[model samples]
Target chain A: MHEWTIADNLVRLVGEAARKEGLTEVSEVYVKVGVLRQVIPETLKTAFSHLIGEIEFAGAELKIEKIPLAVKCRDCGSKKAGDDLAFTCGRCGGIDLEILAGDELYLDYLEGKGNGE
Target chain B: MKIAIKEDILKEEDRIGAENRREFLARGVAAFNLIGSPGSGKTSLIEAAYRELGGELAIGVIEGDLASDKDTVRLRNLGLPALQINTGRGCHLSPLMIKKALPEIDLAALDILIIENVGNLVCPVSFDLGETAKIGLISVAEGDDKPTKYPLLFREAEVVVLNKIDLVPHSDFDREAFYSGLRAINPAIGVIEISCRTGEGVEEWGSWLRERVSSPAGR
Candidate 1:
């Protein structure tokens, strides 16, 4: 839903990192997105592509790592993928659960070369 | 070379949210984020609360919608301080919007600030607006399957308000199923049944709200 805002922040962060490292080009930006974010990958890529130029990273590509939903059963202490958005424990059939993942939206790294020409 | 830049995507928004929280705390203002589906009686609930508890508490509202000042007008007609934010096509209200709207409100004069979020259950839950409490509304007309379908919103909210209880007899709403579904998602969530039209259970809701506003836990 807010892919544009996420993309804008991604560009700002990558630009900041590039500036700090004295890099002229950011070839790729790796991001980890959890399932709960509900961000469309194509929309995020488009937003990133549109804004990358303003941050002086014209040819940078956005790489997204889709993280599946993972939850832990509070009763049995078993962890598994939360399929169908049920979130209930698979083994114990318990409603008491703790979410271990699937809400993350963060920038992992940027791959590029320093000014060496 | 790989340069590690592990940063949350909503870092900027969170920063703004923290600022808003600090401001609210400093002013001793109890802020609430009111979220619900479209036509789920969010405005009606606010109006009902104001009618019942206006003498005891001064309420201000920040109304968010896709593209209308209609709700803002409705609140202002009651002589209450209200600010309308038209997001155009945006799905949710961000912390920046709250930060900007703070200047329009006299934080010192207000005891409670209700930020009525844009109508949508899914997108609004993800964005934190630095509210003291997150209250969700579900009308009986919306069906009891809402909690099952949108578990995240139900799970995250501190209070789930079941509005339009006055029409329960006319509709096909299964109250037991609704409660069961909500309990499945959140065992301790406070569900207050109220009808803005009939004023049923509005006093109980008001008392619960006043307790939150006066208590340190809500801060």
Candidate 2:
């Protein structure tokens, strides 16, 4: 599934950090995923499991937080939680909304001193 | 051993892409990432562009595909700095590939660098290559509901070229619906109806291209 592909991205992120900073292993990885990104987390974790061995990120834990679809209505200027992909203002009929959150894909940090390879 | 470091991985990709864009802009060169589906007439449009402004404008192409360099050959035969990027089985082109290929491009002398992305509407919209404008190509035969079905790509595009209009008569689709759908997603987007085969609206696209590629910001 595309979820596994998403995990590959996470693993790649961690692997890159590990390789560049000169680490033998990674301990933890934190990510923020927004709902609007249309990505599934379980598949990403599964992909991470396989890719962990490539850069000595084996045994590293992946922590992710899902960001809700928060949008700002253009007409009312009120920020609200969007129900789904099709965003509309709940307070007003304004359909012009800006996404405030939930399209996030970031690697917050890494923790570990990998043995010198 | 436990070592804690703070980083954002997505930022890294964006940073690299931003850096590349900065470098081009610094030298007064602008780049466009061209995207669309197979047989959407991207190569044809490129050829038409070559005919119109290829003489006055200094253009280069980075063609991305899973296997063939046929498009690359076509572009090269016309005597331009054209390169082919074979992605093997990859569905889309990444900024990393562009970074690797930048060395072959002389940004100082060129007016435009067009990256013809793999022929897919879905995956390519997600990646940013530090392009100044994303030119979304959609043929009339592909169905006018495309804008509604692929809102992400339409939203990402600065200009949407409804190419291959000559075949519109043979297809059952609503052109107005396509425009309205796109406007619903993005009102400010520039829409041009063109047919590369008959040179219809090619001048309009080329004229718009000339203005952008010849601006002070562009080399």
Candidate 3:
């Protein structure tokens, strides 16, 4: 349900980037969503499709890349996959860990045609 | 042409939340963001906390709901300064909304501000509202698997309030599972067990709140 808000923010973000580049029509928008963000790719796409009718984003494609959860072990200094949700160090079975990734929600860039193209 | 513009979509929200944090510090106000599933006893816990700490601390509330001003009315009826933000169809309250509510609150006169986020385990955790701490509420009625199911909230929560412990005897709420689940995400997170109806652990919760609010080194 909140995917719409995410989509709206993404559009505004990409639109700003596009405008600064003098891009009149965006061809694609690439977004990276971390696992911890819990953003459904399909829902985001549907939300984006809903807003593509707007002149600025019309005909633009929404692309999303899912990033897995990763953590940094404080004891062994190892980066471990956080898929287990156990927070344990996969190397030494230590519990001291800091989340290194999987909370991201950002726009990577915009691909489009500039004005007068 | 492709522009190499890598930016966080929620950076604006983060910026606004930071500004709100500064304002809170300038006013000597301690704010907390309360998040959980709907009917997880957030309102009840707030009301209980108000009853416990209202005299010692000048507390205020920012109620976020999809619709209706019921929680706002309830808080205001308790004689505390309260503001309600109806997101309409939105799932969570953004820092911008919190900024809009700040004017309604007398920050200088407030000792604490509690933002009761829209009842959601997902969206509310994604947005920061400039609070000093994020507290997650889970009622025993909601099942013990909530923390496992919604790891993001538990992972980010500085404190987790397990409300309705009074019903633990009546319900199949596994205490071990809940605590272990929370520990799996955040090893050092504080967990408070309370029952608003029976006033079981309101004092503990209130004491934590008081400490957080009055301490010079606010968390």
Candidate 4:
């Protein structure tokens, strides 16, 4: 499994998002990581830990939201979670399907000390 | 009343990366971050390319690997200016690493600098390397589902090379699925199928590389 390196890169991304949202003191970061990505959560945590000191997400919690792979059948228009890359239409048994979910890896929202809600 | 410098770190990093790229371009050096899965022929392609075009082009390489200088040694054996970065246990190369490694090499002398990123399909795509292009290598032996399954690399790549095509006669890779998936996700991306070993489609790849980097308005 591959983990995003440069340790500081993820920290910077989380820190920037926090600043823009004014959730300067992020208590938690909600990241949506796709299953297809070989991102190891633990390694990301380790990278984040080393990097958080340089930015606003310092001491901030990292919350990972794992997104499973989902596909929408182009043949029959049925939306379903992909099964082992079968990615076939559930209703019509057609093999042509378009991926609808599970390619995402980004910061979504923050639970923070200053979340304006 | 805020005492903290509340910031999204990625944005800050990207800001720095942009500046670095600007400086690099100003110096007339174009960089490319080459990424792919292990055994996808990332290094071999670079060696093949240098042997064919190195004399005409002043090429320099930065090799990223988990713990060995084996790949870097290969590049050096070719007599190309090579820098080996031993990442110990790290999985991918990031902009910061490039920025750190840039000073070691004479960035001003080369027309192109190729960064052979750690061999992985996913992690390497997320990081920016202050490069003009991100070329992803996918071999036929890895199956055609790679583009669809690993969408991030596919989406990030400016050009995708389906390497080792000569072996397709013996493999079960679905070519149609590969093309369709890439087209659906990234219509603007240029696709080239080549056998790095037999030199089957390298002329096209080299031509494509030269074309993109030499385009009048290219950055």
- Please give the DockQ score of every candidate, comma-separated: 0.57, 0.36, 0.74, 0.17
Candidate 3 C-alpha error for residue B92, in Å? 0.7
lDDT of each: 0.87, 0.78, 0.86, 0.75
Q: What order do candidates take by DockQ, descending? A: 3, 1, 2, 4
Considering lDDT, where higher is better, how would the candidates rank from best to worst?
1, 3, 2, 4
The docking category that best describes candidate 3 is medium
Once all C-alphas are superposed, what RMSD does model 4 give against the true structure?
Answer: 6.2
Q: How well is each residue in A5-70 modelled by candidate 1, as lDDT tens digits?
A: 788778888888889999988899999998777777999999899999776789899999988888
Question: Each candidate's root-mean-square deviation in Å?
Answer: 2.3, 4.1, 1.6, 6.2
Q: Cα deviation in Å at residue B55, candidate 4?
A: 2.6
Considering lDDT, which of the candidate structures 3 and 4 is the better prediction for this target?
3
Where does candidate 1 stray beyond 4 Å? A74-76, A87-96, B216-219
By summed lDDT, the worst window of 10 consecutive residues in model 4 chain B runs over B1-10
Number of the top candidate by DockQ? 3
* Per-residue lDDT of model 4, residues B69-185, tens digit only: 888888888898999987777777766777888889898898788899999887777667788888999999999888777777877788998899998999998889888877655
Tens digits of lDDT, candidate 2, B28-61: 7768889999999888888888888888988888
Name the better of 1 and 4 by TM-score. 1
The stretch of ten residues in a row with the least summed lDDT in candidate 3 chain A is A81-90
Better structure of 3 and 4 per DockQ: 3
lDDT per residue for candidate 3 within A3-69, as digits (tens), equals 8878887777877778778888888888888898888899999988887767566888988988888
Better of 1 and 2 by lDDT: 1
The parts of candidate 4 lying over 4 Å away from their true place are A1-61, A64-117, B1-9, B216-219
